[model samples]
Target: MELTSTKQRRAAALAIGAASVLLALFVDEPYVLLVAVAVICICIGWEAGLVAVASAGLLSSVILFSLESGAIGGAVRLAVFVVAALALWFVIKIFRTMSFYDRVYQGAGPNIADIPGLGWSAYPDGRLRFVNPAALEYVGVTADEMRRIMDGDDYHWTQFVHPDDVEASMARWHHNLETGEPVIDEQRVRRFDGTYRWFRDTAVASRDEHGRITGWYGQMEDIDDQKKAETALRERERELRLLVDTVPTMIWLMTPAGLPYYFNKRFLDWAGIDAVKEEPRGTRQFASHVELFHPDDRAAVKAVFEKSFARGEPLQHKGRLCRKDGKYRWIDSRFEPLRDEDGTILRWYGVNFDIDDEVRAQESLRLADERLARALRAASLSELSVSIAHELNQPLQAVVANAGAFQRWLTADPPNFNHASRVAQKIIRNADAAAQVVARIRALFSKTEGAPHAIDLNVVIREVCDLLGDTLTSSGVKLDLHLDPRLPATTADQVQMEQVVLNLVRNGIEAMQNVSINVRSLRIVSRHQNDGTVEVEVRDRGRGFSNPERIFEAFYTTKPDGMGMGLAICRSIIEAHYGRLWAENVETGGASITFSIPIRAADSIHTITAATADSRMGAFRD
Candidate 1:
């Protein structure tokens, strides 16, 4: 075959065109220069040639028209330029046709067979026409052996396919031949050594100018390593799936955006939700899961989930999750991020466990505490009933006496208006006093539901001391009060707070009953602490507690007749109000029980209306 040099032709044509441009510029004989330009353009090639010829024609006309020539000379020059351009166009047409055929011939050379992978071609009848050395090597066969196999009466190239893949391969081949479409498939082919390896084959239908199929040419790439890797990965995935299903706890897997995609069997059974079946339409898996939560808890769960998803943080939420039977059960759900080596979250892994029993247990304990508090209050009120009645009785008798005296004065023979007015004033005063006494008694024993409210600890101490005044007098115990009027207000249940103060004062009085009158001292003090708290202390100059700490424990006390719930209830109340109640032995030979309640933040404290309490009383009359 003779070789054609495109580079040599290109250089020669470029030089000729340059010379023609110069000649057209300097020579007055524009027609001769135009002919030379046309020749150079035609030799250059197709589309490029047409552009060169047109440019040359324009340049030649520009030079000729600029010459000092008559009309005949210009017309002749124009005619010559037109004829040369026409001649270049015809030559370009032929050159284009020849170039197309040359490309086709070059594309058919043996270089394609030397491609990295296996290469082969087939006739329209699906018979192997050629197989490259690479293809034969992959099949572990020589050229002669491959030919011998192809010559058999019923044999085809598919005979070299693994037995398991031969049927499908043959079917696909036949389909390709009938439809004149491409054949692209992956299958295992048997080598001469009887070992099968995977290969990916792709063949496109070779067509002629009429677009009719003539043959098929394709390549086969060894994909044995890739197939083995995929198989191993699938096996590992199966093992992981089996392990997930068999585990006891409910588990789920979600995308990094918190959309659940996988759920273990236990999770499905727990909520009666299967991710594949119960998935919401055109929405994320979380949409379906959000419904599983108790309606009141869904918003909280979503808020936490979104925050955690955004921050890549772990989330723990406890809420009621709906069961298949329409009942809701408490579940403790926790989500942890599955992170890569760079600490980037790839997905979210979560587990949920039933915690209904634990929640029920906590609720039961709370109810029990409430009942115990009520019982303790009732017991304390029983012990103070006599003193409380005396406190009210004296005021009531005075009102009765004063009213009687006022009536007598009004009925005087010569009515003394001034005397009657004085008597009436006394009657009103006594009645008001009686009402106050009753109010105090009722407030101390009030049993309304307990709720926290801001109150002055100083006032609570004074009221408790006044209510226990008669008891103190009868027991020969001298009561002392050291209250700080400047103490900050703290939040707590008023009734419960009073109960705590009263319990401590009563205990102090009882502790001093065996001492001498002068020595029996029960001192109650209220003061402000530096740490934003109001402290109340009840100190008794009596037998100190052997173990102060143990006294606050439930059902533990020193008194024989004691129900042992007073101090315990007091401690519970103080703690519930976010306060500290503790006891210590005073060095001088008494026990001091001090409780400090934290003052509420200014913004959190509200001025809610409650029964007014009197902080001062003159004396307790026998």
Candidate 2:
């Protein structure tokens, strides 16, 4: 009976040890697990408790190993389990002798406030419960003095807060106390130096076992530098806003998806669109903003804006906008995306430029140019007809004289064969001369019929030179052409440009007709200017003009028989292409006539079309 009782006691002890080990292994809380381990060690001794821990680890390893397939994985998991179990054993053994609640109380008690920064605690009545040594130093007062200060009915802390921020700070503090919410506020406080500086105070309510409020626990951080920086930034933003509103151009800002958010005062006044009142909630709601644009231009402007916004591209478009006085005026609107450091777009900044006057001026200039071109064409046709008649008359008179001689020789007594043959040759030569004159006239008229295209200035100059090869030779003028190979192609009426060059060359030849053959030199140069325009210069070694500027005027002439319309027509053509034409007298006694046409953008089909559009969009530099 004694042996059976001893065996039963041993069995009971084993069951208790097994129960403790299982509880320690499965319990979620560390303190509870430590308590269970302590109970096991006390009941079965540390040696036996270690054996139980190893057994628990072995069980955990077996469970983990079952989840993995490879031997290496299983071994790693077993080693991990063993190390974790050993570590837990040490922790449990070390902490088993200490009280958990006592350590927690020590950590969170008033003693914890004796840290590097200012720390404090307050009761439910908003009275100071505790203040650390650092807090006393921050407030420039001793513990006794702080206690005395808190004893007063009015909060002494309020006296330290900036007078401007005192009321709001106190109201927030009272609200936090009543609602049991965390207090987080930045307020200016009087420092030890008697100067005000910003401080960020954060506090949360400390609760008791019954979840009742105990006290307020918090830390006060010096944030004077941060507050100063924030203030400066706000001031700068205000200044920038003022600048934007006062600027001549209308300015606005929108979200990345093109929803208007801000409009400068100038924009609001001009557009008459209240950005605040017309705030959009979604993409569909923003479509109503299109009403500010003219009905004819709305669809096109909206399409361009949508495409640019969606693709994160810059926006550029010209459209009519409704003004405050119910008048529609043309505007050049541009949108640029504002992006963050990582290149993520944050918002869109825009500007609307009033271009109504500029557009109207351009249209008027265009109409005036058309009228001038018609007048010049009529004048040119009349002069050309007279010139053609004179040229044909000489060749026709020669033909008539030669034919009469041929008929007279053939009719004379039985044909003087050799003389008749000579007369027939003379007749043939004059007929060929008249045919050549007709061909040149046809070529000139054909050029006037064709439109402008992207053509090389060199090619045009060479063609003109070929047509006037005989004329140059007859006038004893040496033609020099220094064409730049790298010259960009110009968008111009090839025929008109050729005609201008021809006129200049002819004028040069005429001007030097009285000079010696060796000195009568005509130089035609085609080159690319620094400003990205194609410049053609026709220089002559002749009697230079006294007033080069007036030479370009209509019906202004230097030569005795000069119509003076040549230079005028040339200037008008150059201006139509957004180019400039000018003449200057050379110091060495000659004239240099130069015209520069802007090179086509390489992708445009028309010369003046794209250039005119671009010029109307912020081309005026201030």
Candidate 3:
């Protein structure tokens, strides 16, 4: 279509040229021919117009000379006309090229106006050439106003930029212009509403074929919302960092693989500034901070940490950690993995809490317990000494009395030998009894009690009552014995059982010693329970026990000169026989101590024997 149009224009130009030439020849009007050339130059093209003007000049020159009159003058006139026409064509061609470029520039204006953000172009000398409509609108300025601002003494378009950012932005822009490098900066740009917003400004130099800068094309992108969001996020991170640093405990963060990346202020302060350089030492490995842990605890702590990290498990360990002062103190270090939604370990957050005080307190408490235990054992030994003295007193006194009687009988006129001999035998018997008591005590301590045998608890109680008969009578305490004749026999060490019954009976007698003679009565009761066990209760009308629960505890006694081992030993003996002993205050204003022994021991003969020995040992040791 374009080719067809060009051909038609050429045809029209040729026809007009022919008609103009004929008119010039016939009518002597050169102005008419010049009019046709002007039309071709304006409508068609310079090439076509030049052809037509040259053809008219040549044809008019030939026709005028052919008249044979004044040929030179006609030829000069035609040559001048041809030169003028040619000159006109050249001038018109220049004008047409300029006009076409002007139209193209005008067309680009609307396209630039349609851009979303601020856009502008600058000359190579850094002077503003054109500001797009968007840029002018954003700055609340017209093209003329912008031009005036650019031409001002300042001449950098800094008026529309935030004052605080102007200096730096301008410096960067000048540097880029000088280096012919791209301009890239972020700054607050003032808007049409007179409010400043963040924008990212970028520009690149447009270079010509020679690699020289021709102009600059740039764009300002609105980043106000994004910038605010980023600022807020940064502020939030700052606040969180502050909180982590200010907390009292030491804190640290690590990658999922257990490489330490961050440590809080407290950690740095506690571990010392050099701790920051202590990297590659992480949860799985402690090569760098090995000295941070006590030598005794470092290996164990490292093992625990490595295991926890390998399994992505939470860790907790208590051990000594070295402080900046080179002192070791207990620390409870705990670390837990921070996991994503799919349970992938993202980071490990950890803290170390100082537990030195608590650890020291616990050590002090342990020392105190040891001291108390030693004290208790010492007290038990003292009580056992007193108990031995008390046990031997009776037999020694009897031996002394019998010795005196034997002497008296021997000195009587014709001293009766038989009576003296009987008295001597009594003395020997008391001495034997004293030796037996000593031997029994020695065996009890050495865990060497004789084998257990089946014995009636009632019989044991009866024997104890007989042994304390004199004391009961002297104290004016009435003794009521309610023995269960049907009581079952239980297997136990006979001597130990005898000791238990004697202690209980003696305690009852002593309990009522300070009471009124009339009301001071002791009751000894025995029963055979349905549970295949024999039970005996010794009740006293003396002052009830102040502490029923602690009465069985070693070294606990109410009497001024009493050995606290009595009930403790008795309970141990009964328990050794598979029995239990307890004390309680009776409602009738008396204290009752009862013991029950299983009818048949559950243990073998050897076990019961060992148990009896252990029970006696425990009586003093406990």
lDDT of each prediction vs. the true structure? Answer: 0.72, 0.71, 0.78
lDDT per residue, candidate 2, 484-553, as tens digits? 9998777676555665676777778888988778898899998888888888899999988889878877
RMSD (Å) of each candidate, 1 decimal: 21.8, 23.6, 11.6
**Candidates 1 and 2 compared by TM-score, better number:** 2
Worst 10 residues of 2 by lDDT: 613-622
User: What are the models' TM-scores?
Assistant: 0.53, 0.54, 0.64
When sorted by lDDT, best at the front, the candidate numbers are: 3, 1, 2
Pairs of colliding residues, candidate 1: none
lDDT by residue for model 3 (1-622), tens: 3322334655676687668767876886565677677767866567687787887677667766776389778778778888888888888888765544332233224565555688777767786666676777778876546644554433458877899998998899889889999999999998889899999998889887999998888889999999999999999999999999999999988788777778889988997856545554454244555558999987987788878989999998999988889899999989999999999999999999999999999999999988998897776676778877976886787788789989999999989999999889878977877887788777766756466778877777776676566677778889999987777777776666777777788888788877778899889899988988788889999889998999898778888986687788788878877789999998988899999887775345546656766887787777
Which should have the higher lDDT, number 1 or number 2?
Answer: 1
- What pairs collide in candidate 2? none
Give the number of colliding residue pairs in candidate 3. 0
Tell me, by TM-score, which candidate is best: 3
Candidate 1 TM-score, true structure as reference: 0.53
- Stretches off by above 4 angstroms in model 2 are 1-111, 114-117, 150-170, 209-211, 280-286, 338-343, 378-384, 407-622
User: Residue-wise lDDT of candidate 1 within 13-85, one digit each (tens)?
Assistant: 5677677667757776566565555555455444566676677677677777888468788878677777867
Worst 10 residues of 3 by lDDT: 100-109
